[model samples]
Target: MPDYGFERIGKRLFAEHLVGGNFGNMSVRDGDAGFFIKKTGAYLDAPGEPVFVPFEGPVPKDASSEYRVHLAVYRTTPYRAIVHAHPPYAVAASLVTDEIRPLDSEGEMFCPTIPVTTGAPGTQGLANAVAEEMRHNKLVIARGHGTFAAGATLDEAFLLTSLAEHACKVIALKKMFLQ
Candidate 1:
């Protein structure tokens, strides 16, 4: 019933250039057992395979490096899916600002204010920071790293991921050409 469209969303992430090579990850909660996450080193376009991780236990050796962030979100938020990516514009904007207030309409309505937080990449600290904000925001940016977005389904999460990038792109462009 839940849209576990990992492969479909993965392809879109790749086709749209939101991710390049093996730069991002995705996951879906697997009831009380655990969650299924994209494997480390796997390409978003193909998404080699998904690794299952329990709510409490040793993680799979091949799980995505950002697995902790995904796990934390699943445990702390009501969202059922997550999509993480290093979209260029969003990552670039995050470098200079502590928060991103979308200059565009859709970003204004859907996201509006996305908090930018920081922690070393692939650590529990980063996971905690991201999960904490995701509880109150649709998406959170990790300083100069990437984005962590959650939704009831992968489709919804994927859309947020794209929206963040588009909105950030607008901000970046306007700042470059208009400001």
Candidate 2:
């Protein structure tokens, strides 16, 4: 379809280790047919060709298991881009707390408090939880799972994901030092 900034976002996510192997997913709304989502099992840092599926039609065989989450966000929110990843530190931090209170200044400003979602990774419950939080904030952490960030553009969504990871690192580091 169109150059939806997937390549750049993929590379950045991979380089930052926000995702590994075939983990995580990214998607962009394509006018009205539906959305262009990374194919199932494709590496987030290099999801070759995108698979565009109609919102009300059958999903392709290669679509991500969490494609439902992407669709839910597009249907309920105005955001056009979504980035889902299991940023190591962010996911780790979520395991210990329901909400990650960003201790760093940037975290405080951009992610004062990152909310966590509970449920199986690719379930509708998980999607609904993430979509609800996304209405108020651009990023959310799926407890013991990963992070889901959305924005008008892929760049904004990617940045929110990165910022969330950085904040998690700060929180983790501080905890380590204090203990």
Candidate 3:
């Protein structure tokens, strides 16, 4: 039932190009046991079915490659949902700064400052870096990759992804033609 939210979020992500191909993953806490994650290689726009993964033992073989990243955040934070996406503008911003300072009003209020991390995707180093940043920031950009965002719900997490990208777009635009 809760996984339905991911379906909607996924579709939106695809439509807005927040994620393309099989480049993103999402999950929602399903109690203390574990959480429900999108299947590996599943398209966010229309992920066919959900996979319920537990916290105790080994991760399912079919789970997304970034499952470790999602688990790490849930283990250390109160956030119940996570969204990982390769937003073009955000990734571009990461190449230029350690922190993304929001230019838009909504972005300034919601995202404020987004930290950037560097590491190979699905590595503990990357996961730990993201979890560490989540201590004070809900959204963090993984340099040369994308964003790792967490929130009370999938929609909230998704909003951070969108906001980060939008803010980065503004920054990029200003630096380009506006300058």
lDDT of each: 0.90, 0.89, 0.89
**Model 3 agreement with the true structure over 83-104: per-residue lDDT tens digits:** 9999999998899889999889
Query: Residue 84 deviation, candidate 2, in Å?
Result: 0.5
Give the worst 10-residue stretch by lDDT in candidate 3: 1-10
lDDT of 2 at 34: 92
lDDT of 1 at 75: 88
Would you estimate the TM-scores of all the predictions?
A: 0.95, 0.96, 0.96
**Clash pairs, model 2 backbone:** 40-62
Tens digits of per-residue lDDT, candidate 2, 1-179, equal 67888888999999999999889999999877799989988877664898987899899988888998999888889999999988999999888888988888998988798898787888999888888888888889999999999999999999999999999898778878999
| Residue 143 accuracy (lDDT) in model 2 | 93
What is the C-alpha local distance difference test score of candidate 2? 0.89
Q: Which candidate is the best by lDDT?
A: 1
Poorest lDDT segment (10 consecutive residues) of candidate 2: 39-48
TM-score (C-alpha) between model 2 and the true structure = 0.96
Q: Model 1 over residues 1-179: C-alpha lDDT tens digits?
A: 34478789999998888999889999999898789998998987773568899999899999999999999888888888999998999999999999999989999999999999999999999999999998898799999999998998989999999999999888878878975
